[model samples]
Target chain A: MTSSNETVSREIQLAARPQGAPKDSDFTLVERQLGQPGEGEVLVRNLFLTVDPYMRGRMNDVKSYTPPFALNETMTGGAVGEVITSNADGLKAGDLVLHDAGWRTHALIPAKTARKVDLLPSISPSAYLGILGMPGLTAYAGLLEVAAFKEGDVVFVSGAAGAVGSVVGQIARLKGAGRVIGSAGSADKVAHLTEKLGFDTAFNYKDGPVSTLLKEAAPDGIDVYFDNVGGDHLEAALFAFNPFGRAALCGAISQYNATEPASAPRNLALAIGKQLTLKGFIVSSYSHLSAQFAKEVGGWIASGELHYDETVVEGIENMPGAFMGLLDGKNTGKMVVKL
Target chain B: MTSSNETVSREIQLAARPQGAPKDSDFTLVERQLGQPGEGEVLVRNLFLTVDPYMRGRMNDVKSYTPPFALNETMTGGAVGEVITSNADGLKAGDLVLHDAGWRTHALIPAKTARKVDLLPSISPSAYLGILGMPGLTAYAGLLEVAAFKEGDVVFVSGAAGAVGSVVGQIARLKGAGRVIGSAGSADKVAHLTEKLGFDTAFNYKDGPVSTLLKEAAPDGIDVYFDNVGGDHLEAALFAFNPFGRAALCGAISQYNATEPASAPRNLALAIGKQLTLKGFIVSSYSHLSAQFAKEVGGWIASGELHYDETVVEGIENMPGAFMGLLDGKNTGKMVVKL
Candidate 1:
């Protein structure tokens, strides 16, 4: 018999560091006791949890932009949930908030760390973990700011069916791009990119060599490339770029699970004669664009000019599965876990 | 005997396309007759010819930023000469001018294609072919504009004893750089880089692995990398860069003669987490900075604050040999044929 002031919560912990591709044995679900909110703190009942590709880097103990996840400790990520109890100003029990306490059913966090999210009519709380969140902002900043995209430019994006890449391709089209091209893993995703996402052209990278496929798809050459899948995709983009072309290197999902180091992009010397610019950036550096992003992207969503997709997995116990599936390209768009 | 209005000229022509490293058999010395200057034309007595690494690209039959050299035709490059006769208003007899009619003893060219050079007492006319000319502007624009160099940056220059790299290292030091490090092919050039060129530290790339050498030289990491030798040098720079580091992809002399494609810079994926910016540029695209470059670099040379060196290879017939020698890293600075 638990006390009324105490609650039992189930949270996911890192059981072991992944060797290459993560396995079910690498994560474990553990139950913990949580007390009522202390001063300036709130008890959150997590409704949605996000599993992004970047988390793969955090599982490794190497030094990177973000610290690695500790072994046997609860992992943290993006979450959207309702405030169950609050001892903080401007927060109440029924209010919804976006935070970084994901992979768990509940979190007791400082109020300052949680941002109150207003529940709109049609948008679900899960949207805060996908289209209306980090992935959306990454697409906006990487394309417009990092890649320096201009109207009427030919744009190519890799991993076109994934969360960030799908939005990148759509945004390029909506922004008056002359032609938008995409490369994905499957034929259905290729069709989905062309027919549903408004991509002028799309190809299944598994069909043949990316360079030959890219050359056939973009005969005139591409001015901008939003690189989500690295390795062969990056090498192909380098070969297909026209002079003065620019590429925004956002992620390398293709090499994330590989035990061996990536070896493509052998034609980097071509950059010298082509006068290309390849800039790598993370979305956190561009948080200053959030207000402006919310305004522009929010307007597009409201008018039904922009489209978004999500693959939701049920239960906190399945969060690790959802994350592994996300890395394996099992999800078409943003993969989120629902409590 | 030749008439006053007619002259016999000796020129070098491309005999065969090189399979890999260029050799003497790839060139042939030929004699041709030149007529008097026509309208807007001038007859020039060539004084010096430049042998640069970029000329190796023109030897191949591939389409690049510049057109490939035609087979059995006179090979053209940067040259400084004395105008013997001028039908154009701006040029006069005995005036020193710079033009693109190299690998020859004499040339009949249009005045519009030639720029008159002002000969100073202390500066040699051949300086226009090296330190005071294209290579200088390449170093100037590449360091300041392409790399976006600032005052407190720790800079690294590969091929630091070569024409452009030497100037690049010197400029970085004069511009208040926090530290300057350079890598060369030989022990003597390495010593010259640190002792004569004001580089804070220098290393002979042949000693060991470039990554290990660079790590030993730059313990704190580098902010700007002016890459002249690509391949392993570029890969090392990528690993040595700090957060938000920038690299101006100036040249890849190491791979110019390679029959196979280069496979280094294997660590380019590090750019994502480090937020690196790698921009490739050509000197021709930055001609707008010429006047500024001349003023600043000219001032530094005049005050004896900057130093430049040249390897003078005598005779027009030796141009092919000099060019081959340059590719083999036989020259300390600019390699010019004194005709």
Candidate 2:
């Protein structure tokens, strides 16, 4: 469809706080007039939007590292876009940049907030929102630093086919981790982990008990457990942790939407007994390591040691459905919306 | 009491496993004759015995970093003793040393296992079990390394009048922490923290809600939290933690004897939101830093920048009661038994 220059901008806003699982009514789509880019600002035509687990925590009104999205305000998210107009110095019109432009077709953002990407020689610009951006950094920092992985250490990644997990398993292999095991929600995802991501062993969490499966997969015991889905996965990893083991707790997707309080890990005391170190971290905390991460992870990808995948949903209007599917484990790899 | 040499050879063993908390019935005070020290071994007459929270986790028959105390076997603990007989070249009969000797009056230990403490003109040998040994090293490693304290950061210590907490608060203050707040179970203990240990503020947890008191004590929010008593104290610290705060999970005494599983923290998710780091550590993991710790903490103690207290119970026969009392929060600082 050809649009006039005076056409209104389409946007999505938070309608209500979710009780347990978010419903469609929790978000509302509305239209507003597009404004001119102010000084030191660029106007972008958003091409793709990202849906992630971390966004669920942002929807709640409770206090967090970053403020919660105000009710009725535009729902915020990371997006990749092409600059339509620029008053900013470095960025020019038609340049592809990654920014937290929220769930909208067009955004006027400060130039500093947008990172200019050279999508020519390395990879596609969408990878910046998926494997090469927040998700990739989450996997790299959590595994390398928080989990303290050394070569020959047995590593396990839960939610193996998800954005962060996929990258975590691949990075573990690249870092010479021994016996990289993974768990996914479906058989297809499980196969994808071992076949595509180079995981030594992969289990479908829905097929059987997690503790039993973890034992079968990692017979000797796990040294580093990268947990995306917490609950039973955490309990299993704790039971299977060897002495001096480490767990990098990046996300606990399983307990995020629970109406009642979640149960404590059955073997939580094992942390002290095994002298294990369990660290809960967010990717932003280690942002200072980004340049180093890009150099290392980017090189690994170039060498074919690291690989990534994305599940794209067409159009900005489908953002809520895409996010709902993400929480339901319906999407494989990084889930994004193409507008 | 000076007695026949034969009387000094008796040892104590575990007779049975206690159902909940350990009981005197679980101990068997056997009178086995002493054996001659092997080559590179020494005979020790135990002086001071350590009764710590970590021992509680070992009471159950389970795999841990250190194996559980076997039924009808000696219960191991850190002890300071004087070498009575030595076949080792480096150790003499009068040398004061520390070793992992059990609940016994006498022990035959390998020379390498026994660490000799050259008695300082101004310090007592018993300091090895309190301010200069495991507890002190624990405080140093957890506070400086795990919590990553920088000058002017506000610090909060739980179980603040106990062994590790007392040292942690003093060391943080010595390191130029802007404010040091502590929480204990009673008015006397709270007073001890503020008056004797240099805490900027101290509160009796029994007074009211812990989160409320913590907020009042640390109005600007705590930058570093040294957690010794987990459960409510941990929850309170999480709420009062500042942005980019660090939490050192040294011990969790409150949950040691819970008959029923403890409740999950209401604000546990805050760890991710505030970009907070919660690191659970055991002192043995950082044993490599012992010499560095000794240099720094020893200097602090000698210069009067740090102070430590010990709650000594006399006689080896009273150890069970001393241990039970330690769990009951009766001890002011390091709970040591002088035999």
Candidate 3:
């Protein structure tokens, strides 16, 4: 018989590496007793959790920039939290912070892993995990540096209503790009991209062939392509790229959950002919650009030049559902969970 | 039958668009009378010609950095020649110069395309067509700027005995790179890369799988990958890349002649995991860096810090065979033809 004080932690862990598309069975939620924080560590009451596409890659045991999560450990993710009790300096009762504290109710993290939030200026704490954080920096650095955006350059963005993609389209326009076009999975998302985010043109990728839609939207050809969805989206971008065009490959959300390997690009030969520059990048590679990113994106947000939306789930237990919904293109913008 | 004078003026024209790999049947050599030089023009007696991998991309009727080769017109290429007649003010007869004069014995070209060469002072005239020309600038700019080499960084070169790859490996060493590893098709080519070209380690790609060879050569991990052969070589580099590794993709000889579509890389997911920066480039994209290239590389050759080789065929009539050999990886270095 279990005692009343012996509480269950109720955390999810990687059960097995998926061969292709991940299923619910790949995860196992376990209940265990919580451990107390040791020296120089703080116990965080995780308030808001983040479910991102990058986590899907971490589930695989392949070698990458960051190490994969081992089986039976709590699944890793970004989270915003309140420090309940602390042994670390400068952190006190009821102070909010951002950290890579996994999917759980509470965590005991080293002082260094948790960054104290200065919510003194009245910035929303949830925004620290979304628009003002990694996703915003990703859009800024990938578009400006990797894509080499110049004044009057026509830009095209794929998966344009998602977390990073929405910010990418708006940032390109703010940097003086001439015409910005976007692609989304649903009519509502497409409408949001154009009506809410100021995208010049937007298309529902599922409505028709992307090549036909892209040609009609970008008759002059695209100077820069910020790719989030790979597969047919990349092929269409190839056909639509102008001479000396640049492509910033940020993600391939379309192929992340594929049961079989993705198809080879039909227009692979065009890369050489057009003298195109295609760069694959991770946000962490340009971490030095963070201060510059904060200043520019923060100013843009303050001046109403950039806008963002978030889909929030209220409980930590719903993170798996949120992640699955992200893969299915269900969320309109950045997806976060309120703990 | 054609007269010798008519043959001298004639040129091979694009007769049919190639569906996959180009064949000799796609060209038609015809005879015509040479035209006189107009104002600001010089008539060149073409002495040498360059055939490159990028030319293969231009044979198809597609949009590119430069316009596609027109049907029933001379195929465009860079050439070195003697000025037979000059109506341009700054040029005179008997001066050696270089220009984009196409595949022909003689051409009337604008003075702007013709840059005067002082072959009498230092380097051989053929050096202008090989080491001191476009291929040289390509190696210099792409390696130094795009790869971002630092002293002690380990470098790997694919197609290491080829024109650009040979220069890239040598320059990396000259710039204080710790170790230079290279891969070529044959044992003789491998020996040349190590002994003559000064690569620290050289491997015959045909000896075994590239992944195994790469692991043995770069046990510590590759800091930079200069990719000239794309398919398996790119995959191998991805496997061996260290964190923050940079890949400057200059060419993809393995995929150029592929009749069917190549496979999608199974290891592409590594780009995000390792934070690897893989950038595709055409040399001309960095034209602003040309003056700096001329100063540095020009000095390197003058001081014997860099060495280059050319595989030259005796006559322009053998151009097709030479090009075929290039596609088959027969040349040891830069492939050129003497007219």
Candidate 4:
């Protein structure tokens, strides 16, 4: 969908709070008249948007790292856009930018808030929303830094076909992990991990219990586990952890939408005997590492040492459905909505 | 209970493995002929024997930090004794010593495994089995090193009336912790914690729910948690943990005798958002710090800053009952049997 030429901006607003799994009706399409940018402000036409699992946390009225999304207001998230007009000295019209003005086709943003981006010959602007953006930084810092990855350590990753998990497995291998294993929801994604992403081995968690599959994949046990899907995945990872093992707890997509609390790991006692360390974190916690992250991971992508995939949904109207679908595992890799 | 000139040594042996809570039938009273000390060995007439919760873990025929106790065997643990006979260099008859010769009135032990005690008249020989022995070392290393205690950090301890937990709270306070709170199983134990052990506040976990009690105890949040009791206590600590909080997971006494595996903290997700670190450790992991630990904690005791208690049971025949009582929370601090 193109930005309205009639001076009105189309945006997605939270019509109601979700009870469990979010439905399309929970969001509504609305329009607002575009106003001229004031000093240090710019008007942007949003092009590519990110719909991530963490957005689910922001939907709740509970205390968290970020504030909750207020009902009847335009939902905001990460987006890449073109500056239609600028009142700030550093930026101008036609400049491509990245900003937290998602769920809308056009946004009146402070020019200081929108970061100017250079269109690389080899990299797409939308790639900044996935591989070169928050997701990539999360995978990078959560593994090498937060989990304190050691060279030649065996690594296990859950939700391994998705944006962060896929990058974590590849990064582990590239950084000298002895063996890298990934668990995905389907045989195709599992095949893609090993065959396409260069993971050492991959398995479909749907085939059997995660514990049995993990035991078979890494019979000797894993030194590090990057957890994206919590619940049984976290429990199974605890079972397969070696002595002095570390687990980087990044997300719990499995229990994110649950109306009731999820069941906890029954064998957590194993952690005590194993001298295990489990650390939970958000990527934003290590935002200072982004400069180095972009430099390192950017080189990998440029030299084709890393490969990435994107699942695209069309139009701002499709954002809510894509996000819900992402939660349901209907999409692979980074699920993005292109307007 | 006197050393029988009759040449027979009274002992408590594992009669069978326990199923749930250890039963009386699981243990048996036995007798052995007292043998003369061989070369490189010493004959120890046991004075004080320690019965710890960890012994319950040894009863199960599963791999753990230490080997499982074989059926009908005299269980080995920390004890203080008098050297009745010595056939090794540097050790003499009638010398006081400490050795892992618990559950028996007389023990034939390798001299290399027995360390001679200076017999500090200021401190009882039994105090070595509690305050200056394995339990004390466990609390020292677990709190200061493993938990990475920083001055002014708010500290919370679970199983706060037991041998290890009691020392942990005192150490946190003596080291300049901002506030110290403890959770125990009974009103008497809670009273003893706040009234005698110098804890800032103490609560009976049996009096109310742990989460509610914890929220009331530390309204702001806790910076460090020394976990001796696991299960719900761990879950509650996770809830009350501040950003970058650390937990030294010392023991899961609450789950040691559990027939079924215990549920882990369902809200373990809080660890992710708060950048929490949970590290499980056995004291032996830090045994290298024992010399330093003894010097420091011993100094605390010398200054009267450290106080210790032992609930003594007389005779080797009562060893099994004292051990079961330790697990049942019948004792206030260290539970030891005197021969």
Pick by lDDT: which candidate is best?
Answer: 1
Full-model lDDT, candidate 2: 0.86
CAPRI tier of model 3: acceptable
Superposed on all Cα atoms, model 1 deviates from the true structure by an RMSD in Å of: 1.2
TM-score of 3: 0.89
Candidate 2's TM-score: 0.90
TM-score, each model? 0.98, 0.90, 0.89, 0.97
In candidate 2 the C-alpha lDDT for residue B95 amounts to 92
Judging by DockQ against the true structure, name the best candidate: 1
What 10-residue stretch in candidate 4 chain A is worst by lDDT? A1-10
What's the DockQ of model 1? 0.83
Task: Name the 10 consecutive residues with the lowest summed lDDT in model 1 chain A.
Answer: A256-265
- Tens digits of per-residue lDDT for model 4 on B135-224? 999899989988899999999999899999999999999999999999999999999999999999989998777999999999999999
For every model in order, the TM-score on chain A comes to: 0.98, 0.96, 0.95, 0.97
Clashes of 2: 1
Tens-digit lDDT string for candidate 2 (B140-241): 999999789999999999999999999999989988999999999999998888887889999999999899999999899999999888777888988888
Candidate 3's C-alpha runs over 4 A off are A1-8, A35-39, A87-89, A118-125, A145-151, A259-261, A265-269, A272-275, A285-306, B1-10, B35-41, B86-88, B110-112, B120-123, B264-266, B285-305
Which pairs clash in the backbone of model 4? A280-B272
In every candidate, how many clashes are there?
Answer: 0, 1, 3, 1
The lDDT, on a scale of 0 to 1, for candidate 1 is 0.93
